[model samples]
Target: MKLQESTMHQNELINLNEYLLTKGFELSEEEIAKLVHVQKEICKNLKWIELDESKLYKIILPYTLSPYLSFDNKMITLENAILIYYKIRSMFDWHLDDETCITTCFKTYTSLYGIQDKELIKTIIIGLKKEGYNNNANDFNESF
Candidate 1:
């Protein structure tokens, strides 16, 4: 998917760590490195990275975040807006990693939080619908 903003979002990722601090956890660079290493190792074990089959999972830049949520039928509820944004960014792994599969991750992950951020979610829902994802934008709020 095309990022609306042009910046690398490094500063935004740093800001996410600060917000995560209040959520009872700290996102450390060391931890992030380890996580990526582990992820890479797992990819290797699955033969997805070094082997063939188009390497379904791709690795690119790394970011971190923590997420929390709540919901009702009328409006989705979130514990923290900032947290969700951060989580969304990290979950965007498959999105930012490659152009072709970007939409796939974005569409599949919209409701992964179990709670939708009305504004941002509205944008994504519409975007996914336009891209032809199988999800009905209006029906999403039904699970809110």
Candidate 2:
């Protein structure tokens, strides 16, 4: 995976929270604590923290989002986008126990969002083609 530099911001956090709310994924106190602890460590480390997909799934266990999407034709939903954002965000440096960490988080969020957007557009085109809307799919593909 390519790592693009991004700055985390308050709006990104707000957007993630809103997305989670829509998905009915509210973090428990314990989960919040764990998130904070992990985030602090990431920030303090100031380097990439290794987190494979399984560890990523465990970190986001509070959410109902599944981590087992098939690679070839995987779809990126809001949940996937948010989680991917966090996973990347966890690898960067930031301020511990402060909202200032938003900068690092925002960076990861935007990068992941770009990747996910491309995935989504490709998925949509595939769906359109499968539904026999070849013309529409071709038009959409051209738009990208």
Candidate 3:
């Protein structure tokens, strides 16, 4: 799938930004663009290839933010953003970086955060189902 196709719409993105504001995070448009870019980059780069664990962490770290900060230059990686979103909101841990894991994390975060726009969540759940994460997909249906 194309990157933008699987990403949030502009208004949904704004909702996300607004949600973040409630958590004391206010990402600028530029930062949000960078986040979208980085997520696309990671997905494109890792689509058919697996990185070693350390390399994967290295690749993912720049996108992570310090949790204590209200604002910073560092942007959250899509994976870590999902992880942190769940962590902060529900105390859930989403630690894996594989495609299914990331997609599920995204679905969970969006659902729990009240994103409400079902297109992205449906897409992510479909992707998970295709990957044989039927249980996970069912959980999303139940939870969201």
Candidate 4:
């Protein structure tokens, strides 16, 4: 049940690709490979803890997909995506508390990346909520 043990699978990749397609992105093989590699790195860097696959996917998918999400009609660069992933991962490792992890990660990412897009923030909040995090839309209202 370790985080690394719940690494992304082929089905998940397919699902991710399908999800992206629904969002108007058709990822090439290279893009899919890059996502897999980055996701592995993200999981590898995290501390091992008992986490269910469903919960892990709910928590991690947003980080994996964030780079592709259009904010003000611009996609976030891969470099920025990796930085944001690690920043959130680092916070998760240090805090080890789901109650504050999402909020802290959101605050830190925005402070460093200067992301002010409401839709992107809402997507992240919704994803985290799927993992059963207590934070809600109200937690982010003042920021956006």
Candidate 5:
């Protein structure tokens, strides 16, 4: 018997998102791309929020819900971005970093904040992760 292998392209498996939107209920390829761009922005913002906590407060403030949050710089580590997404939207508190002392923290930002306009935010977060983010779910899962 011979073993054969087939290849699937990276961007092949996709299910249409009914929640995806434009001015109305429609998402063109360009619109989809735009959504992806928004996700990257959200990821960047999450990272900035974390940096603000780690650097400014000198204490790891519990993550928060930030709908309008954004990172002005394009230098946030992919790891941090993913953590922000998972924590804020999923309410998942896991470690996505090594230097952080504690883990499994609760959200710092208000819950309502994240729930407001959450779909757009979630889309962006998932997009960023797809773009290559390595987050440690344990970061948010650490409690003690």
Candidate 6:
């Protein structure tokens, strides 16, 4: 679903939470509200032309999973994760290039978050690459 510049309604926020649940994120109501607010703020600040449900999910996915992500025995806090996610989103808005944005996100995470686990970083990069390829393929198919 597309979300314009208007404020999200209660039912729409509930639907967004339900959608996140289907994607394996069981966020609380408060968390869902925060995510919606964050998305709106980002779009407003960046002057994004469009804000879709899929884009919101992609933007907040890392932040949602941040609590479970650890590197070198150090846990990534939600606050830090949110910052990283925002940076990545902003980069995407500026560049409109997935590879560059993803790479910059990885680098920023490693440097600022002190992620010292090389193997973990490698796995994350591989996953991002695979996802990128799949998204490209899907975009190609949908364009036809």
For model 5, residues 72-134, the per-residue Cα lDDT tens digits are 311132224344433444332233332232122222123334222334334443443554544
RMSD of 2: 15.5
lDDT at 7 for candidate 4? 58
Residue 51, candidate 6: alpha-carbon lDDT: 38
lDDT of 3 by residue, 1-144 (tens): 445633535545565556566667666777656755654564454352323322333332223323332444235334455333232222222433444354454455445542323444555555545654433222443332
Q: How much lDDT does candidate 1 score?
A: 0.37
Give the C-alpha miss distance for residue 74 in model 2, angstroms: 17
Q: Write candidate 1's Cα lDDT for 12-120 as tens digits.
A: 4456555555554554556445544654555554454433221211212111221332112211221223223323323333323343333333333344543334555
Report the poorest 10 consecutive residues by lDDT, candidate 2: 135-144
Ranked candidates (lDDT, high to low): 4, 6, 3, 2, 1, 5
Measured against the true structure, the TM-scores of the candidates, in listed sequence, are 0.32, 0.26, 0.36, 0.40, 0.26, 0.40
**Model 4 per-residue lDDT at 33:** 60
Error of 6 at 88 (Å): 5.4
Per-prediction backbone clash count? 1, 8, 1, 0, 16, 0
Model 6 clash count equals 0
RMSD of candidates 1 onward, in order: 12.2, 15.5, 13.1, 9.3, 15.2, 11.1
In model 5, how large is the Cα lDDT of residue 129?
A: 56
What is the C-alpha lDDT profile of model 6 across 40-65, one tens digit per residue?
66567657644345454444344333
Query: Which of the two candidates, 2 or 3, achieves a greater TM-score against the reference?
Result: 3
**Candidate 1 off by > 4 Å:** 1-24, 48-103, 112-144
Tens-digit per-residue lDDT, 1-144, candidate 2: 233211232333344355455554544445444554654454455454543423333333323333332223222333443343443333223423212223333333343443445454444334334534323112332221
Tell me how far the alpha carbon of residue 33 in candidate 4 is from the true structure, in angstroms, after superposition: 1.6
Q: Lowest summed-lDDT stretch of 10 residues in model 6?
A: 135-144
C-alpha local distance difference test of each model: 0.37, 0.37, 0.43, 0.47, 0.32, 0.44
Position 44, candidate 5: lDDT:
71
Q: Which regions in candidate 3 have their CA more than 4 angstroms from the true location?
A: 1-8, 48-69, 77-79, 82-144
> TM-score of predicted model 2?
0.26
Residue 120 displacement (Å), model 1: 20
